[model samples]
Target: MRIFALETDINKIKQKFCHSGESILLSTPYHTFSFFFSSIRELFITIALFVVGIIAFIYDLPMGWTLGVLLFIWVVFVFFNLLKAYVDWLYDFIIVTDHQVILVDQTSIYKHEIRPIHVDNIGAITTSTQFWNIFPFGILKIHLKEGLGGDTVMLKYVPHAEEVAATITRAVSSHQSRSQTSAQRRELSGIDDSE
Candidate 1:
């Protein structure tokens, strides 16, 4: 049993999808505030559970079925919410690997969507933020192959989104340069072959 659930989950994903020599450059989840604010209802429920536990302890409730039930309720509430948050934080990520950019969305345990866009296919990158348009956190938007009508990938409430966007942009540029060189060489060879 892995002591840290998040690391364990991430390891599983990496093991399953990462290709040979495709090292992970970066893996980022949404900002912490995003996790808490995304589900306000869950926050309230967690708080209420704490209150109930406190009340039971203060009242010196009988150590019988009632106490067990109370503890059980607390455990379940904490477990479910933690699980949900963990899943959200785990699957909802902006991952940059050597070969491509990966966007993962796991809305539920059984349902997940993984989109991998080659670095050469990325067309644009943008960032939206606060604190003079550059602060605590921001949104990272990645546009893929604009001429091909590729859709955008959004990583909301990402801390240091500006930096992440820059990294992706650099990778895209590097990939494009290599691709263009390869194309030019092929064209030159084709002309020679025709002769």
Candidate 2:
């Protein structure tokens, strides 16, 4: 069920962002551990509230009914919070196409930021994992060429970060080589643009 939903989302994004002849090389979300850590606070609070509510009811404490109602409302709020976190995680993804790399940072239902970096503008790709490689998670950073923002785009908690970085590096290399070949052909054909 979730896989279907994810496919649907990816399809929508491709339709909206991808250009003609652009093919997706890779699409992935942050690691599962990141999602768990992001929502840990809410999970703990929900559990604590449930336990307290149960204890109140069992002890026949004063205002027990009111306490139950309040706890129920709180639980509903927490549930919605968790749901929002899940939605954010589900919608956020990194997509690498033959032409560019797209990062969809979905913060809420109404807000999302899409950053697209052209393959030709990619200067470097790097990945770093935690000490001792405790988990199958790491960060991937793509350093853009100067003047095109001149900043690094970082993706955190990426699963199999090394593989992802390598894929992007290959795409960048291929694009650059193709561009150079076209330029050389133009030069050999005596194509003059300085008119």
For candidate 2, list the clashing residue pairs, or say none: none
In the range 84-132, model 2's lDDT, one tens digit per residue, is 6886677788888988998887766656677888898899999999545
Clashing pairs in 1: none
The TM-scores of all predictions, comma-separated, are 0.69, 0.83
- Runs of candidate 1 exceeding 4 Å displacement: 1-7, 45-82, 130-135, 146-150
lDDT of 2 at 86: 81
Predicted model with the maximum TM-score: 2
